[model samples]
Every structure is written in structure tokens, then in C-alpha cells.
Target: MDKIIIIDFGGQYTHLIGRKVREKGVYSEIVPYDMKIEEIDSNVKGIILSGGPYHVSEDSPKIDPRILDLGIPILGICYGHQLIAYMSGGKVGPSKKKEYGITYVNIINNNDILKGLSKKEKVWMSHSDSVFSLPDDYEVLAYSENCPIAAFKHKYKPIYGVQWHPEVYHTENGDVIFENFISICNCNRDWKIENLLDKMIEEVRNEVKNGKAIIALSGGIDSSTAAMIAAKAIGNRLVAVFVDHGFMREGEVESIKNTFKELNLIVIEAKDRFLEKIKGVSDPELKRKLIGEEFIRVFEEIAEKVGAEYLIQGTIYPDRIESGLRHSDKIKSHHNVAGIPSKIKFKKIIEPLRDLYKDEVRKIALKLGLPKEIVYRQPFPGPGLAVRIIGEVTKEKLEIIRKADKIVREEIEKSKIREKLWQYFAVLTDTKTTGVKGDERAYGYVVAIRCVESREAMTARFANIPYKLLERISTRITNEIPQVVRVVYDITHKPPATIEWE
Candidate 1:
């Protein structure tokens, strides 16, 4: 398969670049910035240099010189553009005015990478350094108001660089840039979801090798899809274990049980157990750690009963990246990633979707004929509602949030924007506000509604929900849920605030 190699320079959206490539039906992989040139597969048809948080004027990691001579199409973004220019006998220096948000870039010359884009288009910019001079054989392809060299390319070779991030949603016609680059690479768009399903089944069968395996099914797309694939590989030998961690959405337990009725499933009603373990845990990371450790303990007991030698989790690339597994920085500790105890030496772990992103996983789920509800379900954190609650885990708080969240979901669905929004849910904060109910003074918990829109969860913008819908959601939550006296919409984006409150 013709694939693209993305060299990671610790950029937040490095994985997002790979996701966008895969969206074009071409496979792509992210490698460390310092990875040896020989380590890259010979079949890689193109290379993408991801933007990082480092400045090119300072001591930044150098790229392997052999990559330019490999005769493959290469594209650089933001910091990547500066690095490429600095490495190829060009000048790079700190920008007097750092471009951090949306900027307009005007095309000086239409290159293959900028093929269907307009003369001037909006692009996302996040950089402190700029390419002061072009390489000997390179010319400026585009320019912006603040930055002179917005884009550049080799005079003869198939090399390109852009001063903005085309992988993010804020950039207009971002997909056009990716499609143009893939066309330049002449890659075969043969990578399909059906092919992935067959490959995963075969790989799972070989890895299990007649050994029993248990899936930590959380009713999410990742775990559900993993369970379905594992079932196809081992049939009755695979057992799907759903542990009710007390922090799940309302009716989640029943919904999961009914969804996997055909599969060999065991429902462990350990809600009280989980709630007790996290009784006084107010710290978000500490809550995740406790839940993760407790989940393993429950799974271990069930694995022993089933005589399973392997543990399957629906851990995808985002989870691994957020958990600081790969070369990326730590955003948060996912239960499936950082939650797993080091003492879990009993069963070998299997994560089939580890390399896939959320959209990719949903494609596999749809290809496998999984239910629409499960396949198109919103992305839920593995730590469940525990992370949604800002303070200590308590029965009273959980009840309040669960009721409020249900109202938020129902109203969003009624607005016919549930599928359009990436994630829309309610959060219970520790704050208390005074209000009047039935002509009486009442102090109740404050509930926050966070809704964001994004193709991938890497970067997100607050969803522009209709004011009527927002008013409806707020009204329903405050009126129906007595404990929630106040409801506020979270307008913050992903940079300052994550999707989840915790």
C-alpha cells in the first residue's frame, strides 16, 4: 500500500495530520522526528513534516538529510516549514508578530499542493518563527499579510511547505490541501474499511492462537468494535465484560447489555464498588488512576473465571497520545492507557484499534454491520462520568449530573444536531448558585453544558448551537432537574479548555 510518513516534532496536531491522510483513503503513519531514515518503510510514497512547539531559531531537532534525497514528495507545516527552509540553506528567524489564530494567505503561484484552493483563503496559523529566505532552488508559493513566505516549494522536486496548519478545521478548504498533496504523491486509494476488518480479524486470530481472550467492553465504538472483531476471530472463546463503574450515562448499563446480546457477555454490577473506591478522590488524575486500577482488578477476576489469557481493549491512537504513550505530550490519562496497572502481568493485552483514530474506528464499525447507535455514538471517556464531575465522586452528585446530561442529550437530539455535534453533555461543577423556585430561595449545584464540533477530537471549536436550542437545553435542565439551579454554556475551545471539564 502506498502510505505517507508524518515525522512528529511534538506538535499537538501531529496525529491529526495522519488522520486527515487516512481520510483520503491512503494509509499514513506518524514517526518520531529523530527516527532514523532507514527505519522508514521503503514503500512510503510521501513525507509530511508536522509543526511543533519549538522555534527554528533555537536549538530544534534536525531532520535527517537523507530524507530530501530519497526522491519522495514532502510537505511541511508551520514549524515544519521553517525547519525545512533552515535545513536547505535558507534563513529562519523569530517572527516579530507571531501568528496564532486564523490568517489569510494569498497565493503567489498555484502549486500542486495549493491546487483547488482560492487565491486568498483562511488558514490556521500557530508559530513564532518565519522563513526569512527561500532555498537556492525554491520559490515562494504564497504569502500572508503578516508573514511574507506563507508557502514555498522546490523549483523542480516535489517538495512543499505551508506556514499554516491545513489539518485543522478552522482552515478553509483544508481537505483540498490534503487531497492535492495525496494526488502529488500518486498514492493508491486502496485502503478501505472492509480491508481493515479482514486484516484485523486475521491478526487477532493469529495473536490469540486458540487462547481465550476477554474484552473490556464499555459500549463505546472502540470497545464494541474491538469485541465484534475479536468475536469473529475466536467465537465463543471471547468474553465481553462490561463493568458498571457507576459513572456511566443513564441507562448505559442496560443499553450495553442489549447491544451485545449475541456475544458472550458478563455484566459486572460493581457501581457501588467503583463509587466507594473514589469516595474522597477530588483530583481528576487521581480519579482516573483509581478507576483504572479498579477496572483491572475486576477484569482480572473475571478473566480468571473464564480462563482467558488475553485482555482486549478498544484503545485507539487518541487515547495513547493523550496518555503520553508515543512521542506526544501528555494531555490526560485515559483509563485504558494510563489506567492499566504495571502489575497486570497475568494476561497479555491486545489493542487492535491502537493505530486508528475515532473516525477510522467508526468506519470499521459501520463496515462490520454494528448497530447505528453504537457506531455513531458520541465519543465518551473511558473514566466515564467520573471525569465529568469536577469534584468528589458522590451518589448525590452523580444523580444530579446524570439527570442533567439526559436532558441535554434529549434537547440536542430534538434539535436534530446530535449527530452534527461531536460531543454535547452536561457537567456538574462544585459551584453553587442562588435561585428562586416556586417563590422560595434555593441554592443548587451549577451545571455546565459543553458542545463542540470537529471532524477529529484533536482540536475542536465550540458548536454554534442555535440560541433557541441553547435556551431550550438550559430551561429543561434547570426546570426538570431540581438540583441544577443554574445552566451555562461553555464557549471555550479546545486550546484553553478540553472537551471534558476534568
Candidate 2:
């Protein structure tokens, strides 16, 4: 059972490297940076050093250099590249000018892993430090305009280093690079979704035992997949709780209901007096906290009614990191953690998908025979339209946003662009602009349409939407939603901006 070990150095795409290895039918696992290098023996055929936020010359944490001495095929990425250079008698320094986005790399030759790749290719680069010098035993493989040593390989060892991320979608031919590494290492092709399903079923059954399991069903891919898996493992003992917080899309409630009905699982539909409580809230964090606290209250009451002992929510890896729980800085508030009240009462909490990322969850969903629509649905935040809208939430605002979002969906579907995008919708803002409605001066809200294409929601780029399609959406939104006087499109990517407006 040959496998590849990925050492996590805190870069956002560390797990993505492991995913790429797994996609090539190879088994991979993320190990802590402090893990012993001697553990990489016998069955371990390859090693991948992941990128991180820390600079190599900084007085921060460092990994054991014995990892390079393990004598296996090693590939260092980004910070991994810097770590190898700094620890192996080389020099590293801050980049004179940071290469934060897309850049072109020139492959020096057609040898080693760069064999089939083109002489010139676009790769994503994000670093504040660069390797100033390479060791005497190493040879340069590729270089960019700014960073001279973009790729390198040692002469006597099977070790390689890449200054850019090969796992990111922005990098061209990234997957093929991993495939070559896996093939060259002769790693086993045993990691498949079917195998994972059997393992998860057994694990869930043992964890739940005879106790009941309660899953918070939000009609999204994460929770819906969690609910389905738990139901299969525990039968009727799995209780599904759906909370309607008055911020969902137009058809979310009925869509969730239909899903559970098809599965024939026991569902407890809980609807709060959403309009009464969140009618005029403005602050983003405050809005999340209020919704979270209110949701816990509803869950407590529903748990009492159903007599369940465990409260399960779909807490993904990114959600935990974004909530500042994992090895990541605080990015945003996940409703399950940031929004839920601290004083929780009744039933222990369980999260099956907590350790898995968004892409992994989709694989699990596909393995479990979930519908295509449900499996590929865009990642929607638990706060729903409440967070997407830029101001205080109200019935009128919700209605206007819902209709505008519906128009976006309809036009996208009609134009056949829905399949090409990851997520697309409309948002209402607090500011209003004056416009002419039937030759009369009228003041109404501003709506911004967001459409993006991404493999996973971790980082995304704006979708190159057709101008004619945008025209149709803009026209329909202004004509249908009287409260909306103008429509604008968001053309920003993820690094400088997040997916949502708030």
C-alpha cells in the first residue's frame, strides 16, 4: 500500500495537493509539520512539502530537515521550496516585489517531471519570499521573470521543488504534474470514493452506536450530504432538522423538504419568526450571531420534541479555518460556530464532514448517489441572502432580492450559462439611486449580480460571463423588481475580495 505524505505548513492549498494526488488514484494524507521524519518509511513512496504563510528566514516554526534525507521522491511547493533551500545550506530573502497572481514560467528543458509540459505555461504564484541561492548539488529546472529558481531538482536525490502551487486551478497543467509524480513514484491507485463510503459508514455506525443523531439540514451540499450519510448509518434514529431563518433563496424550504421526502428520513422542519427578529439588523457579524443564537434556540426546542441526544451540523474544513478554529487566521464567521450561541444546552455536537474540504464533500456526495443538481450546487453560506445583501434585512429587501436572484437564475438557464458557472446570484444593497420610472423620478435599491467559476469555494475568479447574458439579467431585474432601480455585476476575484458582499 504505497502512499504519499503531505506535510502541512499552513498554506490554504495544502490539502489541495493531497486531493490532487488522490485524484490520480493515489492515497495521500496531511501530516503535521512536527511529525517525525522516520515515520516516512516502507509503505511511503513519496513526500510533498506544502506551502505556508511563514517566510523561511523568519524566526517562526520550522520542519525537520531529516525529511529530505528520507531518500524518497520529494516535491516541495512554495514555502516548501523555500524551506528546502534555506535548511540545505542555501539563502532565502524577502521578494523585492511580490508575485501574488498569475505569471508565466519558462521550462528550461523536456526532462524529469517537466517532460511533457510545454516550454512556457501560466502558473499561480503567491509569495513574499524567494530563494536567493540554490545548493551546490541542485540544478535549476524552471524560472519566472522575478523568481529565477521557480523549479529545481537535486542531482543525487529524487527531491524536486516548485515555487508555485501545482494544485491550484489557476495553474495550467497542474493536474498532469501531480499525475507524473504519482506515476514516477509508483504510488498505489487505491483511493476511490466507493472505498471511502464503506469506511465512513462503519465509522459513523460505531460513533453513533445506539444513540440518536441529529443533522441540521440547510438544503446545501454539505449538510444534505451529511444528513444522507447519517441516515444510511443509523436508519430512523437519524433526525433531520431544517431551520428556516427567513434568509434562504426563494425555493430553499420546499427543495429541502422534497430531498428528505425522497430519502424517507425523519425530518423536523423548524421555521422561526424570521421577519420579526431580523427585520432591521445591519452589522454583518451581529446578523450572523443573532441568526446563530436563534437557530440554537430552535434546535433546543426541536431536540426536546424529537428526544435526540446529538446535534450534528455540516462543519467543513474551510468553515472551521474561516471560523479561526483550525491553523488559519480569522477570515469570516461560519454560522455553525460564529453564529451559534456559546451557552449551548442539551445534546452533544457531532460533525461528520468537519475534517473534509468542500471538494472532498462533493466526492462523498457523488459516491453516495446524490442527485447531480444537489451534488454540484454552489456553496451557499448558512446566513443565506442575509449576508449576501449589503444592508439591514427586511421582508421587502428579501422579496426584492429573491425576485432578482430568480431572474438571474432564469436568464442563466435560458442562456445555457448555468452549467459553466460555480455560483451566480443577485444581492441588494443599502444605498439607493434615483432613476426615471415611466418618466417619473423614483428612488430604489441597488442590486449587484455575482457570478464566479471555481473548483472549490476556497479561492475563486469571476466568471467571464457573456455581455448579452448580462444585458438580459439587468433588463429583467429592473423591469420585474420595482424596488431595484439599477443592476451591477461584480468582476472581482477572491484574493482581493470574498464571494459574498458583506
Candidate 3:
């Protein structure tokens, strides 16, 4: 396959870069930073350097200097940009003013890589150290207000560097930059995101041949897609288990049951069982761990009776990445990844869509002929409403959040803007406030509305919802949900705040 090789330096969004490339109809593979040159076979068309949490120095995670001599097209982002400048006899150090969030870059030279971008374009930047000066053979292509060398390219070779991230959705015309890079690589745009369906089903069939496999279906896009793939692969050997963990939104359980009627679904009303383990669990990590373990226990009992030897989950790459990326990209503990026990009773664990993102998974779901409700459902956390509440778990708090969430969803859907926003939901915060209700003083909980626009969950921008819509949501939330006295909308993005409150 003609592909681009993304060198992973433990950056949070290294997987995202690969996703962007694959979305552009070109195959992409990720390798560790220390991957040997021999592994860079003839099929490799280009190379990308990913950003990470480190300064450019000799002591940092070093890349092999030999790859530069290979003459393959190379594009470095943030740290990768600085590394290229430093390696090619340029200067790199802390910038006078660090760049973060949406930034504007002025194109000094319209080179081959910056082919489609305007003279001044908005780009996504999050970095401290920058390429202070380029090498003798390199020329600066663009510059921002703070960083002198925002974009650069070698004079003779097909090498380029950009301090901003084109992989992120916040960057204006980001995909155009990748499209230009693909043209430079001269790759055949033959890959389709939906076509991966056959390969996934075949892999599942090969992995779990002649054995019954039980899947933990959460009714979300990821699990539903995985379930469909599993069913086609193993035929009647697949069993879908839905565990009600006492933390779901209003009518979510009933809706899920109705959505998956074709499959042999087993509904386990373990609300009391899960709530017991979650009670008094004020800590977020502990809540996730408890719920995760109890889920495994429930599945094990069901698997034992069904004679199922393999366990399947809808665990995607973001779930694993947020749960600490298996090594050093620590963010938070996702129940599906970090909360899994060290030992399991199943013969093997299968995740057919493990390498995919939410949007990528949606493509596969559509290809499998899944319903639109299941395919386009807003991304939900595995830990459910437990993560939505900041403090300890209780039946009262769950009811409060559930009602508020429904109101938020209802208002958004009624405005005919649900499809525009990536996720629009409510969070019941731990704080309380005093307000006047019915001409009397009343103390009630605070509910926050979070709506963001994002392609991948790695980076996000607050959705520019109409003010009238926000007012309607606020009014309904406070009036219908009597416990909520104050309703505030959250405008923070993913870098500072995750979608979930916990």
C-alpha cells in the first residue's frame, strides 16, 4: 500500500494525524519514534513528525538522522518542526510568546505544501518551543505573530515543516494542506473508510472461528458497529449483553433494547448492583474502576453459562488514548481501557474497531446498514452518567442529571441543529447556589450545558449555538428540572476541559 508513516513521539494526537491522512483516501500507519529504517519499506510514500510534551534538545526522544537522507517527503508539526530545524543546523528554543488555540499565520511563500492556503490562514497551534531560525538550505514559508518560523520547507527536497497542526479540525482548510501533501506524495487515492468493513468482518471471523463470543454492547455507535461486524463474522455465535449500570440518561436503556432487537440481546438490570459499588465513591478514577470491574463480572457470569470463550468490547482508540495511551500520554482513565482488570477469564479479547475514531466508526456503521439513530448518536462516555456527576453517586443526583440531559437534548433536537453540533448535553455540577423560585428563596443544584463541534474528539471548539436556542434550553432546564436553579453553558474546549465533567 502507498502510505504515509507517522512517527509517534507519545503525542496525544499522533493517532489523529494518521486518522486525518486515512480520511483523505490515503492509507497511513503509525510506528514508534525508534522504529528502524529497515521497517520503512518501499511502500512508504511520506513521513510525518508528531508534536509532544517536550522541548527540542538532544536529551529528548531522538529521531534517526538517517531517514532524512532517504529523500522521502517529510512534514514535521510542532515538536517535529523544531526537531527538523535543529537537525538541519537551525536554531530551536523557547519562543518569546507561546502559541495556543486558534492562531493566524501569514504565508511568506506559497510553496508546494501550502499550495491551497490563502495569504493569511487560521491554524491550530499548541507549542512552547519553536524553530527560531532555519538551516542554510531551508526557507521560511510562513510566520505567525509570536513564532518567526511558523512554516518552512527545504529548498531542494520534498521536506516541509509547520508549527501549527493541520490534522486538527480547528485549523481553517486543514484538509487542503493534507490534500496538497498527498499530491506531493503522488499517492493513489483508492482507500475508502467504508471499505474497511469487509476486512474487519474477516478479521473477526479469523480470530473467533467456531467459538461463541459475547460482546459488551453500549448501544453507542462504536459498540453497535462492532456488534454488527461480529454478528456477520460469527453468525449465531455472537451474544449481545447490555448492562444497566444505574447511570444512563432518560430512557436510554429502553431505547437501546428497541434498537438492537435483531440481535440476541440480554438485558441485565444491574442498577442496584452497580449503584452499590458506586455509592460513596467520590473519586472519579475509583468510580470508573468499580463500574468497569462490575461490568466484567456480570459479563463473565453470562459468558460462563453461554459457553463463550472470547470477550469483545467496543473499545476505540480514543478510549485507550484518554486512558493513558498504553504508556505516557496520560489524560484520564476511561472505563473501557484503564479500568479493565489485569486478568480475565475469557480465552481472548476482540475489538474489531479498536483503531477507529467516532467519525470513522460512524462510516463503518453506515456501511453495515445500521439505523441513523444508532449511527449518528452523540458520543457517550463508557462510565455513563457517573462521569457526568462530579461528586459521589446517588439515585437523586442521577435523576437530576438525567432530566437535565433530556431537556438539553430535546431543545437541541427541536431547533433542528442537533446534527450540526458534535455533542450537546448537560452536566450536573457538584456546586449549589441560592436562587428565588416562586417568590421565595430556594437552594438548588447547578447544571451546565456543553456543546462542541469536532470531527475527532482529540480537539474541539465550542459550538456557536444561537443565543435564542440557548435561552430555550436554559429556561426548560431550570423550570422542568426544579433542582437546577442555575444553568450555565460551558465554552471551554477539549485541551482545558474534556467533554465529560469528571
Tell me the whole-model lDDT of each prediction, alpha carbons only: 0.87, 0.81, 0.88
Tens digits of per-residue lDDT for model 1 on 1-502? 8899999887878888988898799988888888888887867999999988787854678689888888899999987888889889898887889887789999988758898887999999888788889867998989888888989999888889999999998998889999999999999987765578888998889999989998999999999999989998999999889998888999888888888877757889998899999999899988888899999899999988979889999999878877777555688888877988889945578999988888889888988889888888999999888899998989988888899889888888888777679999999999999998999999998898999997778778899899999899888888888887888889998864678887
Provide the clashing-pair count of each candidate structure.
0, 0, 0
TM-score of 2: 0.92
Which tens-of-lDDT digit does each residue in 1-502 have in candidate 3? 7889999877778889999899888898888888888889998999999888778887888679999888999999888888888989899998899888899999998869999788999988999888888778999999999999999999999989999989888888888888988899998877788878899999999999999999999999988998999999998999999998878889989898998877869999998999998888899988998888888889999999999999889998888877877334678888877788888898888989888989899888888898898888889998899989988989999999999889888888988777788898888889999998999998999999999988888878788889999999888888888888999989899886787777
At residue 370, what lDDT does model 1 achieve?
Answer: 90
TM-score to true structure, per model:
0.94, 0.92, 0.96
- Which is the winner by lDDT between candidate 2 and candidate 3? 3
Write the residue-wise lDDT of candidate 2 on 129-241 in tens digits: 88878889988889899998888888899888889988988998888679878876887788774467667677778777898767788878898888878888898888787
User: Highest TM-score, which number?
Assistant: 3
Error of 1 at 140 (Å): 2.0
